[model samples]
Target: MLSITTFILLGILGLFLYLLVKYPDKSIGTNERPDLVGPRGLPIIGNLIGIYLKGFTNFNYENLTKYGPNATSTSLGFGRLIAINDPECIEYVMKTNFENYIKPNLLKEALNDVLGDEKCGDSNENWRAIYLTQKIFVKLFEEDTKKLLNIMEAKVQSGETFDLQQLFFRFTLDTFLKITFGLDKNSFADPEEPVRFAMAFDSVQATIDGRFLNPFWKFTEIFSEGGRKMRANCKYLSEFAYKIIKKRRNDPKALKNPKDILNIFMNAKLEDGQYLTDKELRDIILNLIIAGRDTTAQTLSWMMYNVMVNPAIEQKMVNEINTLLSNEKPIPKYEDVKQFEFVQATLYETLRLHPSVPGSVKYCLGNDVLPNGTPVNAGELVIMSAWAMGRDERIWGADAKIFDPERFIKDKNGLKPSQYKFVSFNCGPRLCLGQNFATIEFMTLTTSLLRKYQFEIMPGQKSPPDFGNSVTLPMKDPLLVKVYRRN
Candidate 1:
């Protein structure tokens, strides 16, 4: 972080540079809207030093709460940033006027390095069709889900304390690969043994996250060790993808599940009737991995922690699960999982509090006015902070910060979040393709865990909800816990 003195010096230099160049203003050659409120700052890097000082989560909260649940702006040297939390404004940006808000240059720069390793389509019509049509084989994931339960059973029998986040990471990784790529090469069976591909993929996530926070990536990236690590990790990930693609091309078993995601994509034809190139295929799988992996695991970790923190909620959810499985002790199938509304509410509540994707940045493709009466200019970046939105008092009443699943349970429509309110899966054109798969994966694991085991948060851990600066919000510290068999 830049010191206060240094920030002032940079502000002076920034103003000098601002005088040399001309940039468009919102109104009267200045942005001084009462509705669009934020802390006053210099000509460029507006309030950035303050943001850096407070950290991302705190910065978001301060702005959203202090400025009201509307739109606020902070102009950096490169571009202007508008932080928006209002649901109506969020809806406008996410859905109503979706085309106008594309991923900004900052996001592009952060993701550019790994783009070529090319894992996932940028969600064109063709990509969306293939993604939405592909039915994830639930049986495959359920089978792996059992393996995860068995592993947990082992931990309990051995009386061992464990990091819940690491466990979920391995489970989600394997489960995602199994359904998406028709592969079952999970090293979560022995997490301590280390999986090169998994570790490398994780490195890619952290490295990408680092870029988001880096204002000097354009200059510093070339000389930094983090940059080198990012490059190496990208290579490792691409090579790993290529190897799977190669193996699957020759193996008939890859098509064993007719609805297999990879098989469907591999067989899919573009508008020109040409099949997706190897690069495209690799990218698609990579996209699925990113979409499916950390988000669920992190959300699961948060759900567990929140439930542990509030035991009555956990008991109520377990009761709901038990009611659904009253007659038979068999594992809940896809249809059966739907009956666990309370379980869903518990998870949804967690999402509201600690959304896996904490914040999103979208570039304004055209000038437009937000519903809250904030006029935005073309080329400015708009940051939609789900983390902050979930905590907005206007949206959720005074107890917005409270982890109360009952809010969702009573509302009936709460689980199906209204447009911008629950954006964990996002909304509109760019909503997540893997939403169904993720929900089922969580249900299968969560429901089964509740059926057989009782979880307790282990003592002496800080339990600070410090989120890592990744694209997907993960706990910076391990969530240690102990488990016992239910009678």
Candidate 2:
């Protein structure tokens, strides 16, 4: 009787095993089987529970090891996500097959909300125009960066160590506004100025970060108070930009090409040979303001933070700057300032560690397979987490997370990853247009600030600012350092 009952139990167990294998969950198991395995997740939510509820900091090394080089997908509320660390695969997506991917509607709309433009409008052209305009103004910016250096020097001399990040934001905002739109509110000195368009731009960045957390709350116009404020700020930015453009248009001198971005923008003609409307002009200008201001400010903050943490890098930068300007005046002229090697290395390292626009989303314009054999369907969004890619041990070797500036000098093969793998400015046609402009600004601010003061982390102060792991990493509190004169 025992033998017969045991035989019956074995039969039932075999039947249950057969059902489990035949009818497995479809989300984790690919529709058409692929060469990758995703993290085991809740039936529908996948990685969403970890991203929003726990924050990225909570899942650092553990997640990467479990998920392989490319491990982000859509489940729960995350529409479509992809995190990549393979250099060969990233090269294919960003370069070899670049045309197949473009920024999606959701991203474009978030940027549009920041600039007060329509959701489905001709957004690409405006970004292109801004890129073209910044190319013209980069020369002018390298020229105007001296004034910002002098201003920073003054702040250093006064013995007031204010929030360096905020100060850099103000400086870059002033530079961008003046050079791009020919509107200068001088908000660097007075944060509460009525025409503080930079604050509006910051509001937009916050909204963009918020969207990533809870996508269900995505129709930002319907829910966010910050969104409403951003719209209002966009209104102010538009009016201010148009006022300048109208003034230029009425002036006879406007016919001639002036040396700034505003002149080129004013005189530009579209494919149809019609000039941009005031609304388009405003959107384009605001977009430039945010791109130019935020990227440079974040980079400068990161550079300073690294220098403070790694005293060796700071001394090297100071020595390089002093040696280059040794024969010249104490305040190095812009032409003379280009000779600093260590400073350049410091900037490169900072960009690697904390890229301002860390990661970006690329929507597949059509169906395509990445070099790593991951097939992306049309209309699907694939996100390249630049932050994750930078910190990957495979890419930068064992010392990936440590703040070391010398890694950029040379590798064993004497090849540089500056362009392909460590892509802060990105690569291919869609690369950052303001790359040179941002570098020059970072070089100038970092050198000038260090020349006047030697700063130390306050007692018990952490090395890098606790940025709370947002879309673009930012300081949880303002970066406050104790300052001392460079005697």
Candidate 3:
């Protein structure tokens, strides 16, 4: 008779053998074509161990560029993953054969656990309602911006060094809550206050990102400490969302006016001519909040970091803002944001280097070949690394790694690059609906802040902060900076 430990070891060995026999590894380039190159993987587990060891971001960068900017392949468990940094290949997956690819079920399940059920197919009415509501609330948004600016000004007067990333996150969250739900979180007013909702939101997003790498995350959620914490946070977030939704639904003034995005959704009808339920409304609002808040805040954080480290670039931006706006009305208005070309260029450059969402994963639906002659079978995962593409010499030329805003300025206007190449806002049918709103919000805040003050890196700090692991790219460490009134 075998002991308990021996029995456990024998069970593991038997499972490994079963997997190996059931799902044999298919060698790449088995046909007449050259093999797609990537880091070699072990049978069954494939590159999971490598990803876990090197860290996902580093592993992606090192392995994706091992053989230049072409598409590379590796196996994860029994599934095949092909990572593409080449512009043409990205276009092929994102645009040309768009219908042949979709968000993977595993990813959907992970997001759904936190974000609620994401409605699919024909959401035009819902989008239009949200857009119109946002347009109407532009003035309110401007007022909120002024309030945040005042907080920053107070910080400058006190001569305190604070994390601009944290400030941006708070500002966006507060503003988004006000505009979307007609509720003022007022996080900017009391910067030190603990924001449990925001913390929970971040934790859930990070946990969801981990789910992409771990196939057995469901089991882990039940047994692991981190996984249990994530589950609790998700519950907290859902309860908060539902509470706000119920309050809004009961408020007669809110329902009567329907000024905020939530009210608009509640009153709006679905494709089947039925009003959107509370659950659907909650999902839409939360999804929009995530979309609107983090992307804008993170991009602003990265943009400020870039400007501060490069004095020349910062000076150019300051000069542009000052020259464009009159002293009487320094803060940019909604219509005025479009005219600040160079300022917009600087924002574009920041996005180019540090896209908020560094990479996106798409699942192949049907067997097809990419433009570069890479064969992709049905049920394979195609990971597009915007981070890698942004730095690829083949796409952005020799100065790809340099922080230069001039790359986006052509003939005194913002140069438009191919959607497939500059995929920060993504491309094709799924292009970000909040692009205009985000731009206006960014420009408004940027112009208002830059006009009054200058940001300097805190003493003993370094440039180019390390990236945090999440669904989005955030600074691993706080972006501490000192704010000073411009002389």
Candidate 4:
């Protein structure tokens, strides 16, 4: 029996060897090709042991730099996952043959539980709707939300100490819902507000956490913990959207010609001169809610933490706000916020230090070779670690880790950003559509707080909020802020 078992194992090994020798492109071994092999991994499990043990923090970027950008591959599972760190190689993948790489099915499956079926999360047709609505309506109408800004400023002026992260998250959530869905679920003021949509938003963070930690939760497989929550959330969100869709479809009187995202969508006609389905509109609304709420909230959390840690920079910002708004009326306009250059720099520096979306995963559409001569197969997963890339010494220079906003003011050639290097909003066709809108919101919110209250970190507290993985990086601990109302 033992001899027979040994014979079978040896035969299988021999077959694998034969395949590699016959077709080098199909196998894991090749000297002529740049393959990233670290230490030996177990069969089936592959290098999951390393990934599981290291988890999030154990992900070593230094190892990649030492091994040439294209030379090293991280063993994810059945396939060898390629890691591309070089800026030129990233440019090639993101721009050169942009369509050849796309968001993997796994991501879509995971996000679909939260994002809905509209393909709004997709880079294609649905995204076009999102881009049009956001660019034309939301971004263009920066001043239209003055009423909302007035409310937030009033709340701040009343002298309440609040968690800026949660407050801003709720603010954006409410703003996005009103802007996109025409529903004013003021989640910030009333925490117990039973907005079914807020519950749906929770699925995004959980799914993001699961994507990094659990390998079993593939896109197609729906029984995973995160997947289950996502499906539930989607069902609720869809039902709620269907109600609105029914109202809009059945009753033309219900459709308000108000200047909001949904109103524009109601009027939108495709290139073929056809109207979009109710499901399409709902999906678009849900996508914007997720995008506007989580990304901006997380970015603000990191920014607030940075302000607390770097008191000098924080004071500079406070001084700028006070000096600018001192003589003027307390209620500042959106244009008034633009003059505070230090605030802009601080936000840029925060994005540099802790980008909301650290990495993006793309699957090769077909066979392609990276700039470093690493061949990527059609189905292999390519991870572009934005966090690692942001902190890359080659790009950011010697004081990469330091919280200095001046770096953005000057580039490596001693000029401004060369268009590709500072990619917090990404680049190319897939660049963030709501970039200007988000910036406006961020600066406005920051200006609102800076002009009045001063946030100082409590003694013996960790300066920057402890970062952990979710759809967006948020505070592991509540960002405890002590507020002193500045006249």
Give model 4's clash tally. 3
lDDT of 2: 0.66
Q: How accurate is candidate 4 locally (lDDT)?
A: 0.65
Model 3, runs deviating above 4 Å: 1-34, 75-78, 120-122, 411-413
- Show the colliding residue pairs in model 2: 45-76
* Residues 380-445 of candidate 1: C-alpha lDDT, one tens digit per residue: 778888888888888888999899988987885856778577887887777776676678878888
Assess the local accuracy of residue 63 in candidate 3 as a C-alpha lDDT between 0 and 100: 70
Cα lDDT, model 4, residue 403 = 83
Of candidates 2 and 1, the better by TM-score:
1
* Segments in model 2 whose C-alpha atoms lie over 4 Å from true places: 1-35, 54-62, 76-78, 116-158, 191-195, 218-224, 254-257, 326-328, 331-337, 412-418, 468-471
Ranking by lDDT: 3, 1, 2, 4
Kindly list the per-residue Cα lDDT of model 4 for residues 1-487, writing each as its tens digit.
5798899999999987775565344223322224454444444444566666654332535445555354333344325566667777788788888999998776776576556575433435544555555544434334334544454456556655456666666767777767776666756456435556665666556665666656666653366565676667667778887787777667676565544666666766666677777877777777777777888888888887888777788878888877766535543455565677778878878887787776677888899888867788877777776667677777777787788876765645432344356667776667777776787778776776677666765566566456755766667666656566565
Off by over 4 Å in 4: 1-34, 37-40, 53-71, 74-78, 117-162, 191-196, 218-228, 253-258, 412-416, 460-463
How accurate locally is residue 306 in candidate 3, as Cα lDDT from 0 to 100? 91
How much does each candidate deviate from the true structure in C-alpha RMSD? 5.4, 7.8, 3.2, 5.0
Give the number of the best model, judged by TM-score.
3
Candidate 1: lDDT over CA atoms? Answer: 0.75
TM-score between candidate 4 and the true structure = 0.81
